[model samples]
Target: MSHSPHNIRTASAEARGRGATAALLIAHCAGMLDLVALPVWVGAALIGSMGLAPAQAGLLVTLFLAGQVMASLVLAPRFGRWPAQRVIVGGFALATLAFASLFLVQTYVLMALLHALGGIGAGTALSCVHGLMGRSANPHRVFAMAGLALGLFGILVLGSGPVIVEKAGAATLFVLFALATFTAAVAALMWLGQSQSVAENQADSSAPTSTQLKAPIPKVVWMGMLGIGCMSLANAMLFSFVERIGMDRGYGLQTVTSILIGVGLFNLVPPVLAALLEKRLAAGRVLLAGPVCQLLLALAVTQVQSLWLFAFAAVVWVGVMIFTHTFLFGLIARLDTSGRALAATPAMLMIGSAIGPLLAGVLVDASGYQGLGLMVAMVAVLAFGCFLRLQWATDNRAAVVPRSSH
Candidate 1:
């Protein structure tokens, strides 16, 4: 009852830190949900509600993702200079308004415009989130926490999104997207405001500030980003069509929806596993293996006729990307302590994601699911090559350290 003023100040600062962390988690989850719920957004809303052809629907999603890539690329370099609170609040508010506007628009052109606007806002917020993570004391674990939050969000989206879209129509789903971003914006406004005490505490917990934020990112970090982009491309290429694949294979709506739920439930693993194995596992080997696993799974899900096999492959397809990308995110954070490279995380991931759906759509229309597999095979080859180079660079760096120390 007789606490000193210093003790009270410390407690308040700790509370603000916790609040900031919570805000970050919510922002990360909300900002990333479009990519997370790709199957529903692309398959159900665009194809089912809007009655767009596969390639056309894919193009709509591609436009949104391209906007995200462009915004993140433009904002990430300035992330260190801008205030995080303003970026997050402004970005999510714009996204919320854009998503909410979808309820009033029916034309494909109008919807596409809104989607691109929403993507720009979401991408700006995401850059801030990733930049904060990169500057954290433990980027790997922080990114893992964000991934873990996304897993929970994914479960809700996959579990309920189909039912909601089925009952209330696609407009309702867009409304929900607006609601999610609005929540993040409000949370950021309340918790991540430019409070000096919170800022000081965050700075204390962050990595050293000696790194020049404007310095060019190292080549190894660029390779790592390329590896992530390829993996993301391969992932979204098949994932955006998981529901359609099931339907095309003659699976009933109920059965496919159940399998999608299974996919969400299974997604809860990799981030936790990555956090646990942060130091124990070899990142290079995981990076090398991730693309191969993704390719095999893509082929399995695409080529298999068996209901159980397809369901199993679809359920676990995203986990490998989550696991490998966690390590890659951490690696890039270490390589580029300035945080600019990590701030471009959305750009790195979404550039390929933007291409994935349209490319897959073209392939599927031309040569069927088997053609999609071939495309994934080619992308996986590029991913493997990038990761191989990353591994070599990491090994060379490790070898040089001991010699330089001596």
Candidate 2:
């Protein structure tokens, strides 16, 4: 019995879909591992082992994010011209080298430079994955899966990272990061090419352009990006200093860590829930719900004195973050079909993450945790307004197009 041509094509498509999913998951997990793990361990190492001032340690993280912003702005837009697989594999290789170089560096400046380089690698890998997801059949589902993978990694790393740092040293964390990136690099070799093909095919089918020209990005897309950035900023402001806040409330380090672990474990819930709910609710509604929940939670935490209450708030905060991020990326995909908007997501998020701590630090120094909470609440309100406008703009655009066609 001979297989029909249509049957063969269906089987081929199925194989490609599986390969693309695997590649996207691996790339996303690799790209985000450093983002999640480095903040936990590297900041402590800089202060405890290297004797850097807290401000200087903060600057190191900023420089690393600066590298990511630079790459997302400079390299990601050019993915259409470059081989996606090569870019991803090269990014992993670069990240591995940068992490390994951390062991050799003793000077603050050198370490900062290496961290920035690693950020570039991470940004590149992340941009490739985002572009691929945006071009896939269902970007919302892809992003949800990506969140789930990151949450799982966060659980393992947050659970064991401090122990590793305590037992061996902070430098060993870099070694583990190197090994993770190397593993991702190896896996990338197998599936990234297939994923790239899927992206190209989708691009051709959706918007075939002469000489690879792209539609001009709309203003609403930029607004959506700004909204996500603000949301991230508000979230990070409190999150970056949650441990200090707990300590100020008289919780011990062990208790604070336990709360954080619970936060990490609870991280797994939102993405899975978002994936299920994406079909039931409008994406804009889901996006709007996140900041609303966050603002209310932030207000509640400000008045709560109990450690358990704070822990509950922290877990809910993580859930809101995962939910917001997944839907926000999906919104970008909808706003800009060319994939540029989604590719810029990491840059926007990193920019906000980079700014939040600095601003929050200043607020805490001047006004204390209560003041910080108030300011974060205000920011969340602003973010919600942005999302509201984005929804309106999207609706108006949809309305205008059909009317103009008539």
Q: What would the per-residue lDDT of candidate 1 be over residues 1-406, giving only the tens digit for each residue?
A: 6999999998887788778778888998888886579889888888876678889889888887888899999998886677788988999999999999998899989988998999899999988878877777678888888888888889889888888888888888898899999999999999985641223355634533545665777888888899899999998899999988988888988998898888788778999999999999998998999999988898888877889989999999888898999999888877777888988999998999989888888888899888898788789889999999999998998777775552
Please list the C-alpha lDDT of all candidates, in the order they appear: 0.85, 0.73
Residues 1-406, model 2: lDDT tens digits: 9999988887876676677677778778777663355435433355444655545666676666667777888765665666778887888899899989997777878888898998898788778768777767678888898888888887777677666666777788788778877877887787656337543334432331433335677798877788888887777677766756775677866776677677778878888988998878787887788778878878766667777778889767766877888877777776667776777767877777767766766777688778888988898888888889989998898887775552
What's the CA error at residue 202 for candidate 1, in Å?
5.6
TM-score of each: 0.95, 0.89
Best candidate, TM-score: 1
lDDT for position 221 in model 2:
81
Choose the strongest candidate by lDDT: 1
Q: C-alpha displacement of 111 in model 1, angstroms?
A: 1.0
lDDT of candidate 1 at residue 375, scale 0 to 100: 86
Model 1 C-alpha lDDT versus the unseen true structure: 0.85
